[model samples]
Target: MPSPARAAAFAAAARTILAVTLAVLLAMAGGALAADAPAGKAGPEKAANASAAGSGDDEDEDDDEDEDEDEDDEDDYEGMPPGDGRDEVFAYCSACHSMKLVTQQGLTRADWAEVLVYMVEEHEMAEIEPEDEKLVLDYLARFYGRDRRARKMGR
Candidate 1:
């Protein structure tokens, strides 16, 4: 059993704690709602929604036009062999020969080694990536290596 004075003090403490808690909770909820609303360049929730709904469609249409322009620049590379940076290496190296011609020749690493050296010496093949000669030789060797002698196509 509490004395009258003690009971009144306890009741006052509980009310103060509850009031502070309610104030903190309301402040948090107000902050959450404001953040969830779009912060437009206009600065108010209703104006942000109106600006987006009314004016943003044109921006999206412009994006579609830009994507179409990029597609206009890409050309298809035909039948390159499997290798890392094969396309870049091919793009630079195979202007003299079709990718098909390079892939068709059956050669050991030593065979392509001589070809690369010959191109570098007789016809300038430009300085390739130091590692690329080996990679290209390996690709050429594996696919075309099985048949060393050439055969003409179509009887």
Candidate 2:
């Protein structure tokens, strides 16, 4: 058998070789990932430049399209009526989810309260203050509760 010192030296050399190989592999993987990344967003700048170089026709059309898009963006919260709790609900809920999803639900006040609890416990929504929670619950119960849903169904 080899001497203990020689065996320890061989083991240390093997470990060093393995560590260097792993480092090189990780570096190569990082380079490949960087190389495969999507190209930067120079698309709109190019389009604008091209439009500038051309006649005014494309620029006018683009302006009209942008105006239409702006209007649609403004209507994103159209379903939620203006009310006391509207701002709170919008600020809290819409941070993560679309307001449309909130407007579609129709639950009783108690159910709405439970939903808030669920949001906190299950989905880790921020805890609303007790006073704010009451306001939000009242608003939901008034506008999106079962009675509103029933009325919509002509009940």
Candidate 3:
């Protein structure tokens, strides 16, 4: 029912509307892509923090591994005989503290037990079985007993 000029005008209006819609859609898409695009440059502080975090994680892993190795050394006597459970005590003791604690103390079995108890009670040392403690004490008493005569002579 439209006249010729009116039909042409309506067609041109519809075409103009479509062009505007297309332009808006393109602008939105361009904005979205720009938002997602990588930042071409990072600030120095951000870059330094990221680098330090990564390096810290690696160092923590290495430190944890070393602690694990120390614990293992304190527990295992892979080559020692069962009768020689003193080795286990030595292993456990030498893991965190030093063997000097044992060697330097001119201690009897009772003295060693007291020291072990002190370590467990005060310093939060590992819990050792009573029998294991006895065995280690006996071994130390037998092997590294004090030279009484030398002490008496004082020479």
Question: What TM-scores do the predictions have?
Answer: 0.40, 0.51, 0.40
Name model 1 segments beyond 4 Å from true. 1-75, 147-155
TM-score of 2: 0.51
lDDT value, candidate 2, whole model? 0.71
Candidate 1 to truth, TM: 0.40
Tens digit of lDDT per residue, candidate 1, span 57-122? 454467777566334312223444344444444544555655566766667668877877888788
How much RMSD separates candidate 1 from the native structure? 23.8
User: Model 2 — which ten-residue stretch has the worst lDDT?
Assistant: 38-47
Evaluated with lDDT, which candidate comes out highest?
2
lDDT per residue (tens digit) for residues 1-155 in model 3: 99999999999999999999999999999999786432212222343354467554454366777667545433333222233444545555665555555555566667667877898898888787776777777766654455532464584
| 1 or 2, greater by lDDT | 2
Task: Using TM-score, give the best candidate's number.
Answer: 2
**Where is model 2 more than 4 Å wrong at Cα?**
1-76
- The per-prediction tally of clashing pairs is 1, 0, 0
